[model samples]
Target: MSDRIDKSLTRKKLDKTLKPHWVWAIALGSSIGWASFVMPATWMGEAGPLGVILGLTLGALLMIVISISYGVLIRNYPVSGGEFAYAFLGLSRLHAYISGWFLTLGYICIVALNATAFSLMLKFIFPNFIEQVKVYEIAGWEVYLTEILLATILIGIFTVLNIRGTTISGRMQFIFVAILIVGVLTITIGMTSSAETSFSNLTPLFTPEISALAAILTIVAIAPFAYVGFDNVPQAAEEFKFSSKKALTLIVLAILFAAAIYSLMILATGVAAPWQEISQANHAWGTGFVVQEVLGTGGLIVLATALTMGIFTGLNGFLISSSRVLFAMSRGKVLPKAFSNLHSRYNTPYFALIFAAVIAIIAPWFGREVLGWVVDMSSVGVSIAFFYTTYTAYKLLKWSEQDEGYNPELHIVSPGKKVVTLLGMIASVSFLVLLLYPESPAALGMESIVALLVWIAIGAIFYMIRRKELAKYTREELAYLILGKDQFKLKKEEE
Candidate 1:
């Protein structure tokens, strides 16, 4: 058994080739997606242009706090597990497992969400070609065979790409992110230059259907889904070819970039199309419709191509980040060791990537409406992880101050850092509670709640089974047991 574990540790190490730009690309690609293209209209429908701006701005500010907390923690403990590692170091083994479990679930749901989003985009672009053949129904939503097949095909392709290696995935992210930026620029130029569009179109920017506070809270609840990918940088900390400070800076930049794009999207959509007309249109393809209005058929074609690329980057980024979480759990003995297996040639967590792909493929069979549920549920999971991470950051900072050997140069501890960390934790908790609020726009359906419960139950059962295997060893023994001497030595040398 010892021999087997040792061999696994040495054979399954992650490759460290990602530079600062690649890390930034992954974070951006993961956050900005087809949803970003259309969510402006949806936000406008809920709260008007002014409301959308306020909500996104507040949400972005909160996300910046969360991102800074993440940066501080990653700087102190730069590892692959991300929140999981922080929780383990500051809290306990059990807390670490739970944090990792929540993050992994969130990442998997994001992958599934993007796969469904991709299929929906295809239907919007080729409404005639992708005919809907209703297979069955779930939760009052009709399931279509064509959509299911399309999503599965996309999942399969990206799964193969991820299993090939992070280098391929990172390069793909860079290319697609470049295209997405160009698309955003084109839309902005088209909207501003169009004679038909006017500032008057954005009248009544503030609507009174909902209170400003409620509107902002609604956006905050959904913000986790929008800004989900920035934390992916820390999840691949070991794979970065830069200092922790640089990696942290890149994560912050990614968040700001995503925020700017989202805000601009809302502004452009509001100015180009009347709020009432946009509200009445098919909300899923609202952005594409706006492009059609501003730039005609040629613009629509270009946007579709760019949006397709964005979806691919999103799928790839989530896959890479999620697999690393699974790999970390397996390495820590919280999950089955098989999940830690890497591709011999590519040095990627192939088994974990395949498992995530299976989930993504299965998600579309439930229909596109369920995508909302998945996104909402994922927000809850992400919030839980964020809360723990922030809490851990606070605890670690306090602990470092009390330690005699603590060096400010090696650790990130400041007098006001605790306050920011506490605010991050509070904000995360607020988002989680807001998501469950019945009247909130981002409220989770009963089905999503049940789905979340089932996932948690599965994690609980897995923990129990793994606990028995780990009980015979002490904490230090278990740590060393999973990470063999050779790998430990390698890590020490690298540090």
Candidate 2:
């Protein structure tokens, strides 16, 4: 039911109205940004430096591989489907629906988690002022004058920028990205300057202890959450001056930048604090404590501020992407039509955005762990989606229709694509196992399994509800929907 949104709201193409940087801003924001502050802080506090490193490594590899596979997909059909397009073009409609649900749910959780984190951090940084002005509960348990006011103000800021238009939001992200780079560089160099970091720490060893292995895998499970921003490339496709090859360039560049940056920060975090403190991060936060310890109150302040900015941008990025998914789906007639309405003045997926925003923010309350956990579980969903897609790509390459974009000979002999696709497949499947392992130090464990089951069940129900309408649409419709109709029409030559 991916592209098969309700008939009245059938899948349609996006308006070509954005700059290329907007694409990079949102995609890169989701892909890496400043999420580093959240993880190793918790991990460093609870597990150890090794656990934090392992968690980051796992997430990065998973995201890179999965995103690379998606990169190949979007290169062929650059548009806003995200997983919706991936499933619609490569796999079953049911699978596409599942992908949509996973990404949607994952990002919704991100928004709420970020908002909550933002509120808490603001209170932490400026306790007295936030206190006197409070109007809501602390972590949903106790009321406070300051926290409420802070949450209200921040949300309002984000909402206004979002509602005003994409241009304003894009500019905001551009500014944040500058700040993000400074914070990331500062943290990385600060940690690097300290004596503990060594090439020795990153040396590979396969001998895995039961405890170490489980902890490593668990942390790794959540690791993919770190690299999820690749999907945003497709979300920004409508804005690109060129459509074809847009997806390929965007994904590759985004991944390389993110990987290098993350690798640097991870090494820095390790060097700044001992393995013992970084691992113990599971209790209060994660490795953030060590950063505070080493960087002094000033460093901590910068990181916390960076986290706040990163989380907000990440939240906004997802809200933007998820709405497009729904909008495309609604146009396809797989779901209700009301989801596709755009605000004439805002030129945004106004209703879809607002609806998703409200739901995304409040939904995290039900979950055991809000932000990272939600993002991790979403990775689980995408893992399933990627497996389906890689298999689909293999199958499509083997026997796809001639007129469509299938390349049978390339699958076997295109060594580079073959290797990357295989890597993508392995990385995805590995993350799935990591998420399920009970003893993982990253803490996903069996609960992740339950989360996956619940999300799948929900997705299944949604698919079944829309099956009848979707059945009428043939592969031809699916193809057009995947490759935006506007994309096929080349611009008339300006004489």
- Per residue, candidate 2 scores C-alpha lDDT tens digits across 214-272 of 55665566556666766766666654555545565666566666666665666666665
The models' CA-based lDDT, in order, is: 0.77, 0.61
Q: Model 2: how far is 483 from its true place, Å?
A: 3.4
Please report the candidate that would top TM-score against the real structure. Answer: 1
Name the regions of candidate 1 deviating beyond 4 angstroms: 1-12, 399-412, 437-442, 478-495
TM-score of each: 0.90, 0.80
Candidate 2 local accuracy as lDDT? 0.61
Stretches of model 2 off by over 4 angstroms after superposition:
1-11, 45-51, 54-62, 128-153, 191-216, 243-246, 263-273, 278-295, 364-373, 396-415, 437-443, 485-495
User: Lowest summed-lDDT stretch of 10 residues in model 2?
Assistant: 486-495
For model 1, residues 1-495, the per-residue Cα lDDT tens digits are 343233333434688878778889999989887677757787787878777777777887898888878888777566787887766655667887888888987888788777777767777778765667879988777677887788888889989988887778788889889888888888777787789788787767666677777766677777888888988988888787778778768887888888888887787788877876887776658877877878899988777776787788788888888989998888777888889888888888899999988877777777767766766677788888888888877765644466755555434557588788889999998898788878767788897897788878998998888888755444543344333222221111110
